[model samples]
Target chain A: MNDKLVTVLADVFGLRREQIVPQLTKDDVGNWDSLKQMDLVVSLEREFGVELEIADIITMTSVEKINRILKAKGVDLEA
Target chain B: MKLDGAVSLITGGSKGLGLAIAHRLRAEGARVIVADIDNVALEALPDVFDRRSLDVTQPDEAKSTVEAIAAMYGRIDVLVNNAGVIYSEPLVNLMNPDGMMHSYDRFRQCLRVNLDSVFIMTSAVVEQMVLRRTKGVVINISSISARGNEGQTAYSAAKAAVNAMTVTWSKELGRLGIRCNAVAPGFVDTPSTRAALNETIIKHIEGLTPLRRLGRAEEIAQAVVAAIANDFLNGTILDVNGGVTI
Candidate 1:
């Protein structure tokens, strides 16, 4: 689950492996914007088999927040 | 619109491609608002339609026009940016003071209407759509001129930018379920084309097109509808050029 979460974050944000951590948010990265915010949602959906509602997308701003939210949403995240 | 029972706003919708699209959407039961710069054309607007006089080239005008449509109706489900104009001016002689000298005034006017108006309208409507979380669709009417028609340098450059904006907005607002796409039409026999176009030049285009004929406005309108209906088909371009631009 940790590995999969890291992969989804890196792909959407174009981040390096080390750059990805559970605590990262918009403040921790420069690529985050309104557009990339959408991109992150799409990437997460494609990567994790989780369809995020717009409200969930807004609330799941940081990597740690996304992981916690996905677990609640029934995404295995391990696969 | 939501395919049915939704509100739509079409720029340049008094006639030609815009009118055709409005008709098609209305046939499918979407409420339509048609805006254009010509009052004469607005008089000829279809029955039971919401028509307005709008020069979308002005930012405030576009904002006010779109906001009014939304307020009068309930929400804007579809936005079709189908307004544009063009003149034949090769880059080399576009500065000609006489016969060869292209009209700079006309070129600037074309960009203002075709390109800048698009930005204003999209910005205005999308902000509302975003706030409402409307998950709307935006279709910009582009031309094969974006593929580099020699006599339409200004048109080509402006439409290329339209294409760029489409992709940018698609990325910008996708999470809200808003999709952005463009439809690039080939030479179509509309009032504007009939006025200044030459048969010989058209013949040359037919020679280039595998279909060997000018496209119709309805054909372009069909492409626009397809883009609007397909939710997953976002950030892409649909060309109805009859194999001309391949």
Candidate 2:
């Protein structure tokens, strides 16, 4: 599950893949402001090839929640 | 993006420059929706355009209008922020016995109509574009007065703000594949231009321009089409003023 998601988060937040975890949240990241939130949305949508609703985008505050939303959208995070 | 079959919403499209833009976009094979505050003018428009009565300064109304258009069309490819007023008043008027300074109320009204309307409409339209994953375009109608025109404090400020917002949005939204641009027209030969400035002032402006004439509404519309046609032309303030600055 951490393969592509970790890479995307790392690229967006300027962090390492090892630093990204399911429990990691916006509060834990220094650059996770509203602007970064948009960057994260763009990256996630492009990487997963899935269109996210506004509600889904707003609720994706943590890595775990992002995984859940992507899974619900039929994205195989594990693969 | 190509204009053919593109869904475009233009504010203040019932008359003047906005109407010209609407016609030009239609000629390019776009599905145009014209929104304006003038209900009578909107009703009088031909059946080719989907016309709506919209006061763009109202945030809630702007949001609902964008939502409705998106719902009906399935997607909105372009938004032209063109609803604005042309106002001219000196910052200070010593000759006037009633008041020496510009009215604060009038200043606020000008900002509400010109600046706030752009913010409201762009916010609503861009939200739908992002949610629907459509790589849209936002074209703002600015004025050469944005560089600072005499006796137009509020108008200049509002248009300058629009220019800044255009560039800022271009940088921020580029990642989402949304382009933001502005067309800053000089004194165009429109009714509003003639109304705002007398014939003498118009002639004076014409003499100042390198092209030795006032710009045409159709020329500004063509610049808008150029902005939309070029995919890499983001964050550009395309001055369509016929070398007035030169």
Candidates, DockQ? 0.01, 0.01
The residue pairs that clash in candidate 1, if any, are B96-B101
Clashing pairs in 2: none
Q: Residue-wise lDDT of candidate 1 within B36-151, one digit each (tens)?
A: 99899999876768889998888888888888777777678999998888665665441232444456887787788779989988998897787677889999998888877666
Model 1 CAPRI quality:
incorrect
> Alpha-carbon error at B188 in model 2, in Å?
0.2
Q: What tens digits encode model 2's per-residue C-alpha lDDT throughout B1-246?
A: 999999999999999999999999999999999999999999999999999889998999989999999999999999999889999877864334366578999999999999999999999999999999999999999999899987789999999999999999999999999999999998899989988876656776888999999988999999999999899999999999888872
